[model samples]
Every structure is written in C-alpha cells, then in structure tokens.
Target: MSSYLYRLGRSSAAHPWRVISAWILLVATAAALASSFGAPMRDDWDVPGARAQQGIDLLREHGVGGFASARVVVHDREGDPLPSAEIGTLTERLRGLEHVADVGPARLSGDRDTAVLTVQYAEPITHPDLMGNIEPLGGAISGTVDSGLQVELGGEVPDTAGEAFGGTGELVGVGIALLILVIALGSAVGAGLPIAAAVAGLAAGSSGIALLAATMTVSTSAPMVASMVGLGVGIDYALLLVTRHVEHLRLGHDAVESAGRAVATSGRSVVFAAVTVLVSLMGLRLAGLSTYDSFGLATAIAVVFVAAAALTLVPALCRLGGRKLLPRAVRRNRPLRTREPLTARWAARVGRKPLVWALVSLGALLVLAAPVLDLRTWPGDASSQPAGNTTRQAYDLVAAELGPGANGPLTVVVPTSATGAADEAVATLRADDRIAGLEPVVTTPDGALSIITAEPAFRPTDERTPDLIDDLRAALPASAEVTGWTPFFSDISDMLQERLWLVIAFVVGVSVLLLALMFRSVLVPLKAAAMNLLSITAAYGVLVAVFQWGWAAELIGVDQPMPISSWMPILQFAILFGLSMDYEVFLLSRIREDYLRTGDPRGSVVRGLSATGRVITSAAAIMVVVFLGFATEGDVVVKQLGLGMAVAIVLDATLVRMVLVPATMSLLGHWNWWLPGWLDRLLPTVRVEVEDEPAPERELVGV
Candidate 1:
C-alpha cells in the first residue's frame, strides 16, 4: 500500500500542473452538470412493509393521489370567528390555486376566535415546488389581515418545505477551520492549501449529488450534511498529508521524495479512515429507510471525493509550494526540540496512573450517557418550529382553542361486509376516552373500504398518542387499520427501533473486522469499537438532555422540547461511528508505527501521542466546530444532528482519545499489538506505516 501511494504521489508531484488541471476540469464539469440537470432533493420517510405504508398504497390504488391536506388558520383578535364573509373569500381564492384540489368549509373554534380552512392538494406534498405553490396562499391571507386579524398556514405542505438557513453554518465552519489550520501550520499558504482542497472537494461532491438526484430520492438535507462532513474531513485529511510532507522537507528530503513519503504514510491513514466511514454509513441500509440511505450514501460520496483529493490534489499542491510551505524566516532558523512535546508529557503522566484516568474518563462518559435511557424518537412537528413562525403560531392557536390532537387526526380504513362493524365502530370510538371526536364516515363506492377519521385527545407529539393508536387498533375490526401523520411517524419510529439492534451488530461486526485488518490486532479493534460506542452513547445522552428534556431548547432555536427525529439516532450512529474510527486510525496507526520501531509499549505510547496528538486534536476541533455551527440551524432535525455530532466528536477527541486511549494502551502493554498467529495468517496484511527507504545511491562520476 505504501509503495503504491509513494509511486502515485511521485507521479502527481512530477506532473503537478496536470493534477491541478484535472481537478479543475472535474469540478467545472460537475458544476455544469449540476446546474443543468439538478433538481431539489426530497425527503422520503416511508417505511416499507409498515401498516401505514399498506394504507397509503391502498389510498394510491384508489386514485387518491392527493392525500396531503393543510390548514389555513385565521385568528380574529376582534373576538369573533373569522367573519363568515371573509372565510368565503379566502376559501374561494384557495380553491383557485394550482395543485389545490379542494377547500373544505371553514370550521370556527368553540371560542369563536379562530377559523380553520382545510386545503387539499392534487397530489402528495412531495414536490420540490410545494413552497412555491403555497406561497400565494400565505400571501392571499396576509392581504386580508386587518383589525387584529392574523393568518397562517400549517400542515403537511408547509412542513415539507421546512426552513432554509442558506448554508450559513458551512461558511462559519470553514472560517473557523481556516483559523485552526493557520495556527497549527504557522503559514497562510500552508493552511490555505487544505482549505482550498476542501472547498474544491465539496463543490464536486455537491455537483455529484445534484446529478444523482435525477434518479435517486435524495433528502434535501443531504447536501448540507455532506458539506459539513466533507469540509471537516477534507481539511483534516489534507492537513495530515501536508503536515507530514513538511516534516520530511525539514528532515532534508527533496520535494518529490517528501511528497512520496508523506502520501505513503499519512495518505494510507486517510484511506483507511475513509473506508471505515464508508462502511459505517453503508450500515444505514440495514434500517430500511430511504431517507437514511440517501443521506448515508450522499455523505459517503463526499468523503470519497475529499479523501481522493487529499491523496492526489493535496500532494500536487504541496509539491507546487515546495519550500514556500514554510515562512522564510522559520525555514532559515528552524530549531530542534530540546524538551518533550506536551502531548508526550501528558501521556507519561496518564501512563503512570492508567487505572485512575481510565476509570475517571469511563465513569464520566457513562454518566453523560445515562439520559439516553429516556430518549424518544419521533418526527418533530410544528411545535419545533421557531416560536413566531407561522406554522408554530398556527399550531399553538389550534392547541389552545380546539385541543392538541385536533392538529393531526387519524384516518382509518376498514373493509366491512355490512354496516354492522361500521356502526359498532362509531359507537365504540365515541365511548373511548382517547377519541376526542369522530368525523363522518365515508365509504368507498364499492362499499369495500370504509374511511373513518378519528381525532385523538392528544397531539402527535404526545406520549399518549401512541397509546391511543394501540387502543384504537385493539378496538377496531381486524380488517381495520389507522394511519395519518401521527401514525405514519409512529410506524417509522417503531421500524427503526426493531432494526436498531441488527444495524448496530452489522456496523460493529464490519467495523471490527476492518480495524482488525488495518491494525492486525484482535484486542485493538475491540477496544476501538467499544470506545467509539461509548462516545456515541454519550452523544445520544446529550440529545436527550437538550432536545428531549428541553434543556436550553430556546437557545438553539427550538420553541419547545421535542422528540428526537426518527432518523437521527440511525444517522448519528452511522456518521459518528465512522468519524470516531477516523481518530482511532489516526491515533492507533501512529502508535503502531512507534511500537514497531521501539518495541516498548510504554515508550511507544508517549512517542506516538507526542507525534500525532496535536494533529488529531486540531482535526477533531475542526469537526466539532463544523457540527456545532449546524446546530444553530432553524430546522430542528438538522439542529439535533449537528448538536449530537458535535458532542460526540468532543467526547471522542478529549475523553476517549486524549485520556482513555493512552491509559488503556499503557495498561495493556505489548498485548495491544497481539494477534494470534492463526488469525493473523487468515487476515490480509494491510500496512499503513512504511519504514523510510534510503535514497537511491547516485553516481559521482559526473560531478
């Protein structure tokens, strides 16, 4: 592997302009393709084989393409239901809008302070232009506002549009990463090279995803997430190569040899880390969710581009800069280290007190992870919207006037042999305490399917809603099934829970095998997996504390505590596991290198820590900063992802990497590198560290 990378880097350095030109051409072509054929991404949350999915299929078979309905809520501050005259005017205008199939009669709240008009679309609210189609509805309503009258739109359509922060988080993340790189490398040119590579890689990635959207059901959030992951990892990958190349240059190696050696060593780590990430993300397919699959695949593509560019583009750029990578003054007055690096010093201290540090770090992580026991996974609803946003205001108004459950009503379809079950269902439903009200039953033309709408007594976000669903299923005929927004989301959550264990097992199994192959150690992979999971669990606890427990929810732009997104845990684990493996590969691979050289476990730990600690921490810091920037986004789900990832990276980098890793390695002694002869023979030899080969002897006759 090292020889291959050395040859590849040598070629790239030998023809630096060709590598740079090829990257430019690829980026330009991708951008052009994206601009020409790219379409907006859609979120697909439907769970295959779920009960709700069956109901939806039935509805689609019935030629009922327009199952998505919304509410245009008008609040009259004059203490009267939206004037019947005004309701007629708004309803007439809404009926005339494109994609709008029907506008139901206005229903006034019992308090006569608000009126809601139900608007049905001609198809499921999945179109990219849904917001464009609905903008006129809001605009029309706003014009009617007078004398304390307010208008807002809510329901499936508006929710599908979500909120756009216009990539602000990505920009802030890049800026902070640039500062960190500058500080670490101590040269603007040195730092800028990685940032530039990251930008180019992200641009190419976005273009590729945009093109993929033509055939695949990519989520709207995929680009945002891909950019977030790409920027951080891209910078880190390039930073590693550039840092190593500079070290080689300082050791008196020429530009080409330095680039070759750097890529041979550090570049291998980047590829291993990237492969781990891709493997982890691919585990999302085990959950059987299109949205998760889309995000996972999209992010995997971005990481591929960044990782490839780090090996090819970054080395080319490093060769181009040559001695310019360092400031002139520093290069001329380079000083040798007289004292051990701080990382080595700290490692020595922890090595002597391995048990104490290990216990303290493990105990802290476990404590932080305890809150995950109470974690709830549900699709966040209108309640998670910004406080003053129209959707949130409308939700608050309905919950205040009509009841929380009125915000989302369940639609039940039952195949009846006669009117007997239907009549019994109405009576039984009314008598049930959880059923707030029953809409008139509408039977199919063939009388084969009877549709009954039941309004629950609690909101979709309510814990009791799941109970209500269970109770209704129990009371209804065996042929009857309940489905709607609430039930649909609940079904997704249930599906995720069922597959969670399988996905975890698959991810862990595959990850362990990969680590074992890379490190050639059974115990090393096991320890890495355990540490990765510990950090991830700690992150989940943070999500529960902040989003579920409403701890400083407002500070992050959430109006109230909400259930974690159904896809969050699955997505989080996949991404975080992969990211955690990155640090694992960086740290452990370095330690393995040192161990092989010194054959002293204690000394190797200190030496390895000193060599790679600053780089790893800087890399982790870049990732954490990028993730935290996303946490400030207006979309609650994305916000949760950002917060959760940020917390996980922090825990993994500081507690797990800085403390637990060194302590554990110290405690394990030489056993850390042990692989049984039988297993070692069975596994393929994958080497990430290569000893520096002596420069070929040159003939002195010419001189």
Candidate 2:
C-alpha cells in the first residue's frame, strides 16, 4: 500500500503540470458556475410549512388586502377591553388614518377578555420597515393612557416574529469568528492561510452547491453548510500538507522532492482522513432522516473538494515555494537519516506509565461527558430561535402575553370509519381548553380529518409547551391521530425515536469496522471507540454546561441559561462524530502502518506518535481555525457549533492523540494488535510511499 502511494506521489510530481492543470480547470469552472447560479443563504431554510401555506390560503380566500386584512391582538390583565375607554379613544382617533380601510368595532376573543382588532391595510406586509404601522395599531389604546396594562403588539407582522428578528445571525457569526481566529492561531500569518483557504473555498463551493441544489432539490441550508465545511477542511488539509512541505524544505530537501515528500505522506493521510469523514457522514443515508441525509450528502461533497485541494493546489504551491522558503542552513544539504528519537521516547513512556496516562485521560473525558446527563432539547421556535427571524419575533409576541402555546396549529384527525366522524373529533378537540381557534379544511367530509388553529403562548422549544403536545396526544380521543405543525413535530416524534438507534449504530458500527480493517485488530477498534466515545461525551458535557446549563455563563456572555435546543444534540453529534473520525483515522493509520512494517507494538505506537503527532497538532490547529470562523458568524447556534467543534478538535489533537493514545497502547501491549488470524487475513492493507527526489530546495531535518 505504501509503495502504491509512493508511486502515486512520484507520478504526481513527474506529471505535476497535468495534475495541476486539471485542478485549476475544476476550480475555475466550479467558481464560475457557483457565482452565476448562486443564491443568498436563508435560514429556517426549510421549505414553506403547512402553516405558512394555510395562512396564505386564508388571505386569498378572504381577498384580504394588507390593511383591512391585518389582525391586531391585545391581551392585558385577563379581563381588559384592551384599549379601555381611554385606550379605545386613542384607537378610534387613529381609525381615520390613511390606508386604514376599517378599524372594526373591537370585541373580545373567544377567551372573552382579550381583544382582537381588525386592521384593514392597503398593502401586504413586505419589508420590515413597513411594520412601523404596528405602533399605530395600538391606535388609541397604548402608552401612558393604558399604563396599568401590559400592551404587547401583534398584527400581521408581529405574528411572523416581527421585524426585530432580523440580521441576528450575521452579527453574531462575525463576532464569534474573529475572536476564535485571533485566539486559536496566535500569529497573524498562522491565521491567514486557513482563513484565506476557507473563505475562497466557501465562496467557490457555495456557488457549486447552489447550482447543484437547483438541479437536485436540496434543502435551503445545503449551500451554507457546503460553504462552511468546504472552507474548514480545505484550509485544514492544505495547512498540514503545506506545513509538512515547509518543514521538509527546512530539513534541506530540494523543493520538488520536499513537495513530493509532503504530498506522499501528509497528503495521503488527508485523503484517508477525509474519506473517513465522508464515510461517517454518509451514514446519514442510513439514519432514515431526510435532514441528516441532506447534511451528510452536502458535507461529503465539501470533503471531496477539500481532499482535491490538499492533494493538488497545496502541492503545487509547495513545489513553487522551493528555495525561496527554505532557510540557507536547511538548503545546504546533508546525509539523510530515517531514525526518529521522538518516537523512541514516546515508546519508552508507553512501556513505563501507560496505565496511569490512560486512567487520567479517561477520567478527564468522563468529567466532560457528565453534562450529557442533564441535556435539554428545544424546538426551533421564536424565543429559542437564533433571534431576528420573523417567525421567531412573531412567535415571541404571541407567547409572551398569551400563554406558552402560540406559534403552531394543532390538527385533530380521527380514524373515521365513516363520514362526519372527523367533525366529532374536531368538536371534541375544540372543547379542550388547550385549543382556541378552529379552521377545518382539505380533509374528506367523513369528519375523519379536522383542523384546529391554536397557537402556543410559550416558545416551541420550551419544555412546558412541548409537554402540551404530549397532553394533546394523550388527552385527545383514541380515534384521532393528530397531525399539524405541533403534531407533524410530534407526528415525527415516534419515527425519530425508531431511527435514533439506527443513527447510533451506523456511526459506531462503521467506525469500528474501519478500524478493524486498518489495524487488522478487533482490540484496536474497541479501544479507539472507547477513547473517541469518552472524548465526544466530554465535549458534549462541556457544551451543555456552558451553553445549556450556563455554567460560567458570564464568561461566554450568555445573558441567561436556556434549555438546549431539541435539534442541537442531533446536529452536534453528527458534526462532532464526523470530526472525531478525522483525528482517529489519521492517528490509527499511522500507528497501524508502523506496526505492520516494524512488528514492534511498543515501538510502532511511539514511532507513529512521533511521526504524525506534530502533523496532527497542525491539522487540529487548522480545524480550530475553521471552527473559529463560524463562531464569528454572530448567530448563537453558529457560535455554539463553532466553539464546540473548536474545543473538541483541540481536545482530540492534544489530549487524546498526544497523551492517551500512546498511554493506552502501552498498557494494552500486544493486545493492541490482537485479532483472529482468519479475520486478520481479510483486512485490506493500505500503503503510502514517497518517491522521486525530495524537492531540490528541501532537506530532512533533526533525523
């Protein structure tokens, strides 16, 4: 396997022009297509939901213009006319304003105390600025005249999360990215390459993703995701490859040879690591979840581009760097040596204190994982939302004064063996205090299907409100199987339950399966899995404590502790798991290769650590750079994801790779290589070789 890679390395060098040109063409074309077809990324990036469609339908049915069609809801002290005599006088005064088709004679809602105002408008709500009209909707009622009451505004616009939910992501994303990069890289130059690569890759890759999305029916988030991961890994892989090449030049190899050397060793490692990430991400297909499927597929595409860039552009640049970058002392040239003492030192330690190291690392990881025990999940509702989205604001207004259930419609469906059966179910649900407004449509007349439009006064992500979903399900008639935004959410609840195991199995099983093949050992995979699990658990705990439980919240600038979003764990697991595989593959491949060549378990572990550990650190550093970029995106979720990933990468690189892997291997001794002989025979061997001369300008150093 090494020889094959060695040959590939030689060939790429021998035909650098061809390999290089192909890459240029690919990227250039990709850039063009991407830009020409690119679309601005939008969040909630999901398709228009049934509720949105229903609302649109209702507007059309009523032929409601933006003015007269608008509905203003006011809730105060449970028994307030809302705009009292003083308030109503103010409301009446504004009734004569232009664009006011009609201000209905205000009346209380079904609850009998809160009032609903019908504001007739001349236009449909467009830009947020137009929402200024909401201030006047308060008409005669709000301000000092209605000082005793808490008057919250809810009209056509606020019902959509209002104008305030705008640009939250943009502001947050930028701030977080800047802070992360400055801290992680330390030096300006160190930060530049990764950021440059990430920016360029994202710019080009997003365009490609857009074109693909147009043709492929992709989810809205695909483009942003593709851009994010593409920039991250592209810069990361390039970082390691270039850094290795530079080090070789520093050692006194010719530029071409140094480039070849870097390409063969570090570049090959990247291919393997990236492929591992791709494979792990591909597990999404088995998750039986479309969201995961989209995420996995888009991520895989980005990985492919990253791999290509590392192998091609990075090497081309390395070759170009040559004598210009190599120090005079390094370029002077000397006899080459392959022996590495650093490996020997690690080997000695493993043989000496493996048990202590392993326990300490494992224990530390467990402490981090502790936060998972109290993990809280939140839905994608207004308050818990990243903030500034119209839906988020509108939902917040409804929930703040109304009650917890305000954002979604509740649908009641009965197993109607006959017609009108649905009507009875609808009526039964209507009588329930939990539901308020009723709008039935599109179902067969057998009353088998009826719809109730009820909003949760609390945010969707709130624990208390989701409980209502459970209550509605449990309390509703046995004949009814509810399905609406609330239930479609609840509706998929069971399905997701069934698939969570599949997701876990796919991630764990594939990881183990790959390790078994790479090391030809059952024990290696088991140990690797254990180590990875510990690391992942620890990272999750940290996130939960910092973000969810808000431990040391002030340090992170979180104003308050909020429950973890419901989808956060899933997204976090997918990303972290895939990234964990990145470091895992890099380290294991090196160790296994060394073991196969030297057949010295202890020495192999040490040697592997020595040869690859530095590079692993470099790779992790680049990944941190990538993650830090996202933190700057200014959105809370982006910040969490970025920081979470950055922390996890730093952990895997230093603590897990540098310390624990070696220590554990020392304790395991030959058990690290233990495998059924027959099964071992089935494992495929992979090899990488460096051929051709080291770049004329570079030389091996400290060998």
Candidate 3:
C-alpha cells in the first residue's frame, strides 16, 4: 500500500496541473449531475418494524390513515374577540390552498380573544414535500395579521419544516480553520493547500450525497452531519500529509520526492483512520432505522472523498508551491531550532511519573463521565426548538390554552372486526384519570378500521408520557394499537435504546480487531478502545449537563431542559469512537515506528511525542473549532451533535493524548509493543509510518 501510494504521489506531484485538472473535472461532473437529477433530502423518522409504524401502515391501507394536521392560532392584538368575518375569510383562503383537505370551524378560547383553526392535509406528514405545503399555509394566514390579528402556524406542517442548512456556522468554521492552518504551517500558501483540498473533497462528497438521496430516503440532517464530519476530517487528513511533506522539504528533499515520502508515510495513517470511521459508520445499519442508515452512508461518502483528496490533491498542491510551502525564515536557510520543544520536555516529565499522571487523568475522566448515569433521551419535538420559532410559539400557546398534550395527540387504531374490543378500549381510555380528553370514535366508510384520537395531560417529552403509552399498550386489547407522530417518535427512541449496546459492541469489536491487526499488539488496541470509550462517555456526560440538566442551555439557545436526542448516543459513539481513533492511529504509529527502530521503549515514547505533537495539536484544534462552529446552529439536534463532537475532540487531544497515553505507554514499557509469538506471525505487516531511509536520532533531555 505504501509503495503504491508513493508512486501515485510522485506522479501526481510531477504533473501538478494534470492532477489538479482531473480533480476539478470530477467534482464539476458530480455537481452538475446532482443539480440536474438529485432529490431533495428530508428526515425519515419511521422505524420499519415498530408497532407504531405497523399500525400506521394498516390504517393507510384501509383508507383511514390520519392526515397531517396544522393549527392556525390567532389572537387579537387588543384583548377583544377575534372578528368572525376575518376568521371566515382565513378559512376560505386555507381551503383553496394546495394539499388542504379540510379546514375545521374556528374554536374560540374562553376569553374569545384567541381562536384556533385546524387545517388537515391530504397526505401524511412524512410526505417528501411536507414543507412545501407549509409555505402556502403561511401565505394564507399573512393577510389576517394586517387585520389586527396575531397569527402563528404550528402542528405537523410547521413543526416538520426544519431550518435551512449551510449558514453562519459553516462560514465561521471555515474562517477559523484557515487562521489555525496559517499559524500552524507558517506559510499562507501551505495552509491554503489543505483548505483547498478539503473544500474540493466536501463539494464532491456533498454531490454524491445528493445523488444518493435520489435513490433512497436521505435524512435532512444527513448533509449537515456529512459536512461537519467531512470538513473536519478533510482538513485534518490534508494537514497530516502536508506537515509530513514540509518536514521532508526541511530535510533537503526535492518537491516530487518529498511528496512521495509524505504520501507513503502519513497517507497510510490517513487511510487507516478513515477506514476506522467508515467501519464505525457502517455499524449504524445495525440500528434498524432509515435515519441512521442515511446518516452513516452520507458521512462515509464524505470521509472517502476527503481521504482521497488528501492522498492526491494535497501532494499536487504541495509540489506546485515547492519551497514556498516553507516559512520565509526556513527558506532563507536560518537555524530552525533554538532549544528542545515543549512537548519533548513535557513527555519526559510524564515518563518520569507515569503512575501519577495516569491516575490523575483517569480520575478526571471518571468525574466527567459520572453524569452519564443520569442521562435521559427522547426524540426532539417542537418544544425543543428555539423559543422564537413559530412552532415553539404555537406549542406554548396551545399548552397555555388547551393542554400540553394538545401539542402531541395520540391516535389509536382498532380493527372494526373487533367491535367489542374497540368499545372496551374507548371505555378504558375514558376511565383513565391521566387522559386529558378523548375525541369521538370515527370509523371508515368501509367499516374496516376505527380511528380514536386522545390527548394526554402531559407533554410528549415528559417521562410519564411514554410510561402512559406503555400502560395503554398493556391494558388495551391486542387488536388496538396506538399510532401517531408522538407515538412514532417514542417508538423510535425505544428502539434505539434497545439496539444501542449492539451497535457499540459491533463498532468496538471491529475497531479493536482492526487496531490490533494494524499494530500487531494486543494491549495497545485494548488500551486504545478503553481510552476512546472514556472520552466518548465523558462527551455524553457533557451533553447531559448542558442539554439535559440545562446548566448552560441558554448559551446555545435552548429554552428548557430536554432529554438528549435518543439517536445521539449511538450516532456519537460511532462517530466519536472512529474520530478518536484518528489521533490514536497517528500518535501510536509514530511511537511504534520509533520503538521498532531504537528498541528503547521510554525514549521512543518521548521521541514520538516530540516529533508529532505539533501536528496532532494543530489537527485537533482545526477539528474542534470546526465542530464548535456547528454548535451555534439553530437546530437543537445539530447543535447537540456539534457541541458533543467538539467536547470529545478537545478531551481526546488534551487529557487523553497529552497525559494518559504517554503515561500508560511509559508504565507498560516494552509491553506496549508486546505481541504473542503466534499472534505476531499470523498478523500481516502493515507499515503506517514507512521509512525509505534511516530515521534521525533525537536529543532526549529531561524537563
């Protein structure tokens, strides 16, 4: 693999324009195709085999499936009764709009100053263009606002019309990344090389996702998630290769030769890191949700393209810039060193007191992880949206006037064949004190199914709501099933919780095996797995504190404490675990390389840290900043994911890499590289830090 990559890099560098042109053409073609034929991405929360979905499908087949409904809440600016004439006109306009099936008579509140009009859609909320229906509905209500009425649209239509992607968050991330790169590389041209490669790769990957959406149900969040991962990994990968190339240049190697050496050595690590991420993402399929599948596939595609760009485009750009890739001082042949680097000194100090450093870092991580014990998860709803959002406004209004459960009503579907059971279920629901209100039963014209709608006294996010669902399911007849948006989301949360361990097992098992194979060591892979888990759990703990516990929720625009999104644990595990392995592979490969060459366990640990610390820190900073930018996004789910990733990267790079890793390796000594004789023979040699010539000796000094 190294040999082939070396040749590929050399050829690409020798003919830089040709390589650059080829990449440009490929990206252009992909973008053109995507724009011409790709489908719009949307979230699909359906769990295929869940009972809620089964009930929904049965109702749809019987021509009695519930239609998507929206509320048009109006309030007179002056505390006076809403004019009947304006209400009549608004209803007529709503009825004439596209996808409008029915507009119910206006129901006035006790004060008569507030009125609620329900509009039902012809199709289900899962319709691909559900947001399209929302626009016209909003237009229909616009005229009423001018006539002294304050109107807000809410319910299924407006609640599902998610925020637009690619806003302030992305721009801020890119800007910060560029600044970090420039400072780290010491040359603007060199810094731009990584940025250019990353952007090109992101463009190609996004187009691929768009094309993928045409063939499958892609989640609306898929592209945003893909972008966040793609940009971070893309820049980090290119930075690794570019940093290696710069080092080769400093050693007096020519452009093409330097590019070849960089690709052969650092590019191998990039491939390994990307493979781990891809493998982890594939584990999302075990989640048994289409949303998870889209997330995995979209992110994997981005990673592949970004890694490819690093191996090819980065080298070409480095070659084209040549000596300019170096800083002005270095290019003028000035002395590059004055004293031992700080990392070398720090590494030596940690090596001397390995036990103390290890225990301290471990204790800190455990403290951060303590919050996971109280972690609560639910699928986000209108209540989780920003307070200023229309859906949230409507949610607050309905809860105030009607009931909190009005925001998420439950629908019970009963087969008409079980007439006695249907009657008994209604009686039981009416008897339950927890029930807020039960609508009259409506049966299909064909008399095949009976639809019973009931509102709960509590909000959907309330823990008791799901408990109520469980109680109903147990008490109701087998023929009666509860199905609605609220129940659907609850079922999804339940399903994800059940399958979380399976996904973690698959991802961890496969990753550990891969790491073991790559390093030809048992303890190293096991250690890496344990360290990665510590960081992941710590991230989850932070999420619980900020989002669930509402410690600093206002900073991120969250108005109230809400359960962590159910899918986040599995999603974050797969993504953060894979990403954490990135720094692990890079750091461990260099350490292993030095250990193999010198046969000095302690010296190798210090030398590896001295050699790779700057690049690792720079790469981690870029990832952290990029993710933090996305943390400011409007969508609560996106914000949580972004913040979680940023926190994980920070902890992984600082405490885990700087303290725990060196401490553990120092304590283990020669055992860090220990492989059983039989196991060593069975594992194929995979060189990540290939050397064509002898490595230079380092001046190891104590702090």
Instruction: Output the lDDT of residue 199, model 2.
Output: 54
Location of the lowest summed lDDT over 10 successive residues in candidate 1: 694-703
* Winner on TM-score (2 vs 3): 3
Q: RMSD to the native, candidate 2?
A: 7.1
lDDT of each: 0.84, 0.59, 0.88
Worst 10 residues of 3 by lDDT: 694-703
Instruction: Give the per-residue lDDT of model 1 (tens digit) for 513-604.
Output: 99998888999999999999999999999899988898987788776778888878888898899999998998888888888878999998
Clashing pairs in 1: none
TM-score, candidate 3, is 0.96
**Deviation in angstroms for 249 in model 2?**
3.0
Residue-wise C-alpha lDDT for candidate 3, range 1-703, written one tens digit per residue: 9889999889989999999999999999999999999989876655677778888788778755566778899987677988899999999999997777789889787788888898887887778667535778778988998776789888878877755454787788788889998999899999899989999999999999999999998987888889889999999999999999988887778899989989989989999999999999999999998888999999999999999999999999999999899987787767656688788899999999999999999999999999999998898877888888888887888788778887788899888898598898999899888889998898977888888999999988888888888899998889999988888888888898899999999999999889988888899999999999999999999999999899889998888999999879999999999999999999988998888888899898899998889989999999998998888888888889999999999999999999999999999999997899998888887767656464533321210
lDDT-best of 1 and 3: 3
Instruction: Tell me how far the alpha carbon of residue 104 in candidate 3 is from the true structure, in angstroms, after superposition.
Output: 2.8
Q: Which stretches of candidate 2 lie over 4 Å from their true place?
A: 1-24, 35-204, 327-351, 386-396, 407-409, 413-450, 453-459, 464-467, 492-494, 554-557, 596-598, 632-634, 688-703
105-159: candidate 2 lDDT, tens digit per residue: 6645445455545565555453333343455544544552356654444444444
